[model samples]
Target: MITVKVPLQEAERAKQELMRQGYFLSGYSVQKEGDHLYFPVKERFDSPYAFEERALEARPEQPQGLRETLKGKLPADVLGRLKTAYDQVGDIAILEIDDKFKGYDATIGKALLDTNPKLRTVLAKATGHEGAYRTQHMRLLAGEDKRVAVHKENGVSLIVDVEAVYFSARLSTERKRIMERVQPGERVLVMFSGCGPYTCTLAKNTEAEEVVGVEINPRGHELAEENSKLNELTNVKNYKGDVREIVPELGEFDRILMPLPRSAETFLDVALGASHQGTIIHFYSFLHEDDYAQADTWIQGVCDRAGRRFELLGSVKCGQQAPRVFRWCTDVKIL
Candidate 1:
């Protein structure tokens, strides 16, 4: 159930009547807009009549603002708006946060705080921006699916839906796992760079000479740039095109990340097209619970064709998408 604070002239009497109908409210306050009342809304109403009566009795439209009515925010709407702002310019990132933590509930800027007559005398400076650019409605797409999250060094948030966490969970150890290992004076190539998470992540952590990432989808490309800026990774450059074309122009790099799980095998030509004899082609592929040997065979075949050998560096159980089986990772070093 969500709580909404409504204003009422006869709040005491209304509270008594509402309690008789299994509804109870006890908070009261007033503002320039008018006297406001606080009420608790049930998670579910018995029938349309129950909902209708509550709205009629409270009249939510009369409130000073509609912010009090929101609860259990949806993630899609914010993600959609983020894509828009990011596409127009790569510097902006969508600040995804709990709806309960937004609006006046959000970190009130000093300007708004200064207007409070009591506060004006206590402070000198009063100003800041959180950069959250959406209002209205919230919901969550929840289920048994795997989860993944992205964050950069620039105090920017990059949340992405990983196909499977068993493989993607590497994100949690950003400071230790991958980001911390990269040194200065290196060139890195990130393919299938969705939202530029890994690309930006590596760039932020490494003192590398250059960091290049390519994403096929427009939304992902836009996010990649935004994420790059979020991490304040000035050296990271993103190509808003397919990796097949972008990889060739990049020439050679010390390390190459082949992150596309669906058909990473097919893109071997592209990886080899830009890679040298000792370049490590980090790849991801989906396999059955017992297909480890088959997966190894597949990797061997890929290595042989390019006249190179592969050494399995690590494997991670990212998370589960199925009841019996889970997502897995195979980090191979190609030489």
Candidate 2:
């Protein structure tokens, strides 16, 4: 077999480039030699790395994905409407199927299960997030009939009840980003913290003096406490109540996180009440790409009304909620 010999420092970049060009051979493990790595390939190609002949070990073939498994099983028009992307929470897969394909949901769910053997259950979104808790209903389409899942991220385990709580596994990277930004011994507050994903992640991964979470939803708060215990974190505390009523009692914090993208602006005063001078606030909002700057304006308006000076640190597009609309995070520092 032909192999691409690359230095350990350049292995990742070389491998990615080769894979992008459809030259990297799959089903075989990359061989590592002292100070160097060899990537198995089908044929010699023009590259900076030297191509050499070597016998490589073959690994088990990867399983087919939902799209591949459903090919020929469903009509092309229907298959095209099926999005391969699904939110995976531990052993559960949460799918978003269009209402037009309601009749074929079971077939699609079964195909997903066949493709991903590790998934223990599959659910379809039954309704949009609603009520005071922002929790949504889920219809079990395959596997076990359970809504609870134990999700692990950023060295912390979270007990999430999909039907009773609002939790997004998609925010794992954003949670990690906030965790990495936390300074040692700083007190952090997470508003609308569901299942303690942010609070527990910071507690487990950062040396923060204390990480506090306030959740309005009773079920979310209960799970938040359970998750803190599940992760064996002692520096975390959770309070169940409206932020407007609970935040004033918690005093000031060095950092405050507002993760409620929708209507988070309505609670800006509560978050501001818990922030002191030099405090950093991460505010989340959903807005069209063209109007993203509106988030900054909202923060500015709130600060003006509070008679507080603030400086915009940065803004990031965390995830897309719709076409050209995104979940955005705007970071600011109170002056």
Tell me the alpha-carbon RMSD of every candidate: 18.0, 6.5
lDDT of 1 by residue, 1-335 (tens): 33444335434333322432344432322222245554544443331112212322333332111122222232445423321100001111112344443442222222222222221111111122111211122222211122334432322356543221111222333323456556678788888776776776677666888989887766567767877776677998998877777788879887777766556778877876777755666666656677645556777777687787767776654434356464555666666
TM-score of each model, paired residue for residue:
0.50, 0.84
| Stretches > 4 Å off in candidate 2 | 1-63
lDDT of each: 0.49, 0.87
lDDT of 2 by residue, 92-197 (tens): 8888888888888888889888876767999999999999899899998888999998876656778889889999877776887898899999999999998899
- Overall local distance difference test of candidate 1: 0.49
